[model samples]
Target: MRRGLMAWDPQEVPASALADRLARLRAELAREGVDVFVAYTNIARGGSVWWLTGFTPYWNEGLLYAPAQGEMVFATALSKRVAEWISSVMPAGEVTTTPRPSAFIGEHIARDGAKRIGILELDDFPAGHAQAILQAAPGVELVDVTEAFARARNDSDAVERLLLTKADALAQAACGAVDVSSAHARDFIAPAESVARLGGAEECFTLVAGDLRSSRAFVRTDSMGSLGETFAARVSLAYKGAWTRHVRSFAKDAGVQQSMDRAHAALMDFSLQSGETLAQAVARTFGSLGEVNNWVAEQPRGSYPLAPVANMAESAQGFTASAPFVLDVELVTDGRRWVGARMIGL
Candidate 1:
């Protein structure tokens, strides 16, 4: 569950911006001959809904229904007591809280004689909700519109870019707050989480790699043993509805630290141009720093908050230029491993 600030700032995300996003989505739906579009939202995968509406569900789950011409409606399983609060944060035309949100949405859309319903990430949508919708509107044809939704959401608006920048800054500050001198890995948790929460993060997940030599896998724990010669921490944060990640590594040896610092400088200076692939971009930036062991790029796609779009292993999936994404890299310098990640593409 989210444990930090959860308020909507109209100054940051004006109502007009939300309306424009909805309009673009509806235009895509029209091209697909879809009468209405439905998107599912949970605490885990709700980027699509958050991109459509300013609201992100802290717990339970919800559904967003958008018609071709009318305003969008949100139905959630949350209690009625929080309906007013949800409305204050969400810019949906109607907000209803009920035990069975799918049934409510099915009945609501069926009343409008919706002939073709478009579901985002339909393959991964809950089976029970799909059944409920089919049970209510037996004649309505349900079609998968994940591609359409992705096309509609491909463009990153200025407001979202600003939010992502703030989120990345928060993650960097949180990771920077860690006490590198501490011997125990547990000591790194409190300072990072505290800084992120105090910095207006809606959610923060901090992972610590006690030792890079033994393993590079990051884990969330408070009972870690003593740190080794090399340690690293990764902080993933959500500000408002935008998400970002930042990773930092530490070293006990002065020489190793210098090498890591050089590699990090290269990462910070990296940029991808219009016709450049991620592999080409990495090689251009980090070719002289060290051996590029691995790299992966992620972006908000479909229902996933951060889905892998491009990676070293899979070069087929290309990334969009000037779109917000997180790039994680692993470098090997003189047999020493250094891993770092940051939000790129603004």
Candidate 2:
């Protein structure tokens, strides 16, 4: 029997569902007497920009304009295509693609008859943006909503449950490749040539293999080709993400196998003692409200006892299994071997 990190997509949250969520968020802004909520993204916000429009713009800026009295509108410095996509989420907002985002925003605020303004950033925004907004709407109540916006944006999106499902699968494939390489024969062509081969197909795996050939089994490297070694990974302990998809094909090390045997026995003992299977533990973790962003942002912040599955609902045209579950979990034998659960599902 097999079970592991499953990848999946939740479902398309309708525009109305997104609107309802935005209404709830906007209502919170209104309660705080926030006249508007402004946010920008050169890349990704921790969560802010995506909350307003179902789209998190890359290489652009996004804004959420809410009047205490009228419908909230989203603003951005993206093309009409981008605006149209966001319009599906917020039918009332406008989009622009000018060079000076601050100036464009200032002009829009003034033109739209805004009186009180709540900018998303007071510290982060350039002084010029503040000056422009003030020049455009001088008499208006100009306050900052950066903190409020930050807190509001932290809430998870229901649609993200679907994206994470796909993310988990990608993470699994990476993990699978890692496992395959790790347990494969440690073939060191040499330092003279090892550096050159680091960026090809097996860069991530070979870089470490070369260092292990030269240094102690767990020594670290600064750079081996394009694979810049960041830190030392503990030899026996597989990191959460690293072990999520591929089971180490067992390197046949006596010590490693012995330790594995002990761990397996311990796991079986625990399972019988607790009256639950490993699958039950995973299910509990899955239900932990950590269903967003590859489940990387697990709420209440506790690592799942196993390597957290990266994605669990994304597959092919339907529910086809695409990743393995590498349980760093344990199973103990009567006295011979160790055991851990796995997902060999397609």
The candidate that achieves the highest TM-score relative to the unseen native structure? 1
Cα TM-score per model: 0.97, 0.49
Q: Which portions of model 1 miss their true places by more than 4 Å?
A: none
In candidate 2, what are the lDDT values of residues 45-132, reduced to their tens digit? Answer: 3134444444434445655555554555555567756655545433334555555566666776777776667766656655766786
Q: Each candidate's root-mean-square deviation in Å?
A: 1.2, 12.6
Candidate 2, run of 10 with poorest lDDT: 295-304
Best by lDDT: 1
Expressed as tens digits, the lDDT of each residue in 3-41 for candidate 1 is 689988988888888899998888998899999999999
Candidate 2 regions exceeding 4 Å error are 1-11, 69-92, 150-157, 179-346
TM-score of 1: 0.97
CA lDDT, every model vs. true structure: 0.88, 0.39
Clashes of 2: 21
Clashing pairs in 1: none
Clashes per candidate (backbone, < 3 Å): 0, 21
